[model samples]
Target: MITFCRKSFIKNVFNGQIRCKSANSVSLSYNKITGCVTTSNDSLPPVLIFHGLFGTKNNWKSISKAISSKTGRTVYSLDLRNHGSSPHTSGTDSTLIGMANDIELFLDDNHYKTATLIGHSLGGRTVLQFAYLWPERVEKLIAVDISPLPTIPQQFFTKTTFIDELSKSIENISNDLNMSSARKQVDDRLKPLITDAFIRGFFLMSLHKNEESEKLFWKFNLNSIKHMLENEYINKIEIKIPFNGPSLLVHGQQSDYVKKDDYNAIRELMPNVQIVSIPETGHYLHIEKPNHFIDCVISFMKLS
Candidate 1:
């Protein structure tokens, strides 16, 4: 098999954040999901990573690099619509089905018949829906801290996250800092409004530089995220047809996102499913135990 070193498909950075080759640059289209593809080896089926709620493709960049360098598989870290650098639309385009469709369109746009998928939280559930709706497109599944059973939106997230307040504070955001410490500086800027350090960090994930304004702004649309809370069904998945594909459910020991009883429903949808739990970790297990998370994914994908 031919093995290629790590690489990116991006043409340039839109200020500090990534800007994948747009429709004008490559055959890629913006209406189709936009993402950063790290590392490449044409011989193996690629591994795609999806971020959870309030997260973007940058959240998994290091992990994607590690997985690709170690496994020799192309890794695509995608920013699902309404989040990150992807186009934000309202109504139908904001649902899980919309995200699943974006993934489908992404594969077709890239000319890949099938690929391994790894998604966390909402991204995980979206991939599950994708598998149920388009089973043939998925070669393998790795869902972290999520299940097929629907999750109540209000219970997980809502306006309580202070997204509305933060959206209003975008104009006051500081100049772009092209360094790792930028998170802390931004965190300090938001610290006055959002007291909780953890919650502040979550909101900061969507923060990006506005190419025209030159001020740090959010890539995600506040309305779309808030809309999920309004429509309860947006969080709940209704996948009736069995996906019947090799799938993995990574449970977080400290998180209530995946309950004990959810396994039967998960197995019902993915009959050939394996459930693994990481100790001392919550919903964002990847951040807590990144190495363990990588190990679990690589082992299941048979890259180790």
Candidate 2:
């Protein structure tokens, strides 16, 4: 038997800031991280997944379901702040460390002492920040196609090359999301700008209807993401404490995000970490090869 849990609670209860034992915190408004939880076994530690930039909790539905179904353990696929149904924040509050703070609040609200943390791309960086600051809260950590340092500008360029396309697509689509043809309209508009059908479909996954207002919207905070690209593209990950627990780095063989030269630097931060490269995959390796990706993560947990 399997159980599904969806949470949308008011998590940020503090007035000013709630600093973790690591003494790290981020600014925010009244925002909460939304997640879909799947559980088959309550005894095993829970697993929480954070998606990459422009992705939502829905992106990991299949993987989350598969993981929980296979291992009989709880799995949570979360929407990072300023993305998905989660509230959008302004400039400084939407950073990787800030997202880490949101994850901290998420654990506290759920009363989870520790969990297996898995993240991809920007999400991978967010989990690393969390593991570094709150090492005790993470039972095991898996990062997909990411490293401790910031990605080069080419990274954002290649992944988000469809920004101009996206902007033009938004202009062409109807404002009323309630229309039955809204989804098709979105797809049609994006066709010209984004030539790759697969990448276009992946971007299409970010579309969501606002039931209350019947208005068009994206799951991600575009301005905040652009801010990161412009200003913090080269900013190093902020972490003083090294997480020495069970850790895995799952990178795509075809991706340069985690280069061969980064192994030693990563090892210095996480001495017990192991790196696995998925053949012929890119930054979105999990989406391209979910079964292989799932096997890697589950096998790592079994060993840990």
Candidate 3:
């Protein structure tokens, strides 16, 4: 059911100490917002996961763990640069293609001739670009609740609305307050729009204590993310090759990201793309309806 080729694509990229279970293992330390996670694993086409804006590898832990346990395959959830553990580099270099290159290099370094890449929101765009660049390297691609086309971020929360809420929450946080208290304050402010308690909690988790100043700062580089908001979300990259690999494009029936107009272009780029619409869910379809998301993935992976 799995075909893992044991061959080195790019040798000596990392020290020879980068061990593997088979010859098909390459490890690449990707530098992003925080730092990097060395990804190297066994046969069974590995699942490379990418998180959305304001998310980290930790966000994908639940679904990834479940997927790995159910399928017995290696699942890699990456924290894109400027968002999670990946180290933040100067400038807002958050191009979709550029981010995909990091994954490509990771695959090359880790001996994985091909992989199943799953991404959500901003990450969906990144994965699309990745497959566009290296169609042969992707065995399967899953895009959750987002397409390559531009969508309005303000739909989540109007600029004035988010700013006003954040400002009020910031004012409540004192030097003496604990993370729990700070999170509670922020949660109270975000409650109206972000109904999911778990997501609200996850966002709160990104807030870290500054050891020196004793102030709380977000782990993600907000500046870099904000800077690329316009440039990164646009539908600029055209797929040169119609990626013939198995593709699953899952979207929420309530989400505006994947509109009817998108179908022609999506099918044009990937003639084999399959679309699944999860009803009663919005942009955060996976998080809003985890079971449905898992079921769709399981059914698709089992096929062929």
Best of the candidates, lDDT: 2
Q: Evaluate residue 90 in candidate 1 and report its C-alpha lDDT on the 0 to 100 scale.
A: 72
Tell me the tens digit of each residue's lDDT in model 2 across 241-269: 77899999999988988888889888999
Which stretch of 10 consecutive residues in model 2 shows the poorest summed lDDT? 2-11
Candidate lDDT (C-alpha), each: 0.72, 0.74, 0.70
Q: What number of backbone clashes does candidate 2 have, counting pairs of residues 3 or more apart or in separate chains?
A: 0
* Candidate that beats the other on lDDT, 1 or 3, i.e. the better one: 1
Measured on C-alpha atoms, candidate 1 has an lDDT of 0.72
Candidate number of the best TM-score: 2
Which candidate, 2 or 3, has the higher lDDT? Answer: 2
Model 3 error, position 215 (Å): 1.5
Q: What clash pairs does model 1 have?
A: none
Candidate 2: TM-score?
0.81
How would you encode candidate 1's per-residue C-alpha lDDT over 110-225 as one tens digit per residue?
77879999989878878887888668768999999888776643442455366666666655445655634555666776777878777677777776666676676677777777
- TM-score of each model, paired residue for residue: 0.78, 0.81, 0.78
Q: Which parts of model 3 are misplaced by more than 4 Å?
A: 1-41, 150-172, 188-199, 232-234
Assess candidate 1 and give its TM-score to the true structure.
Answer: 0.78
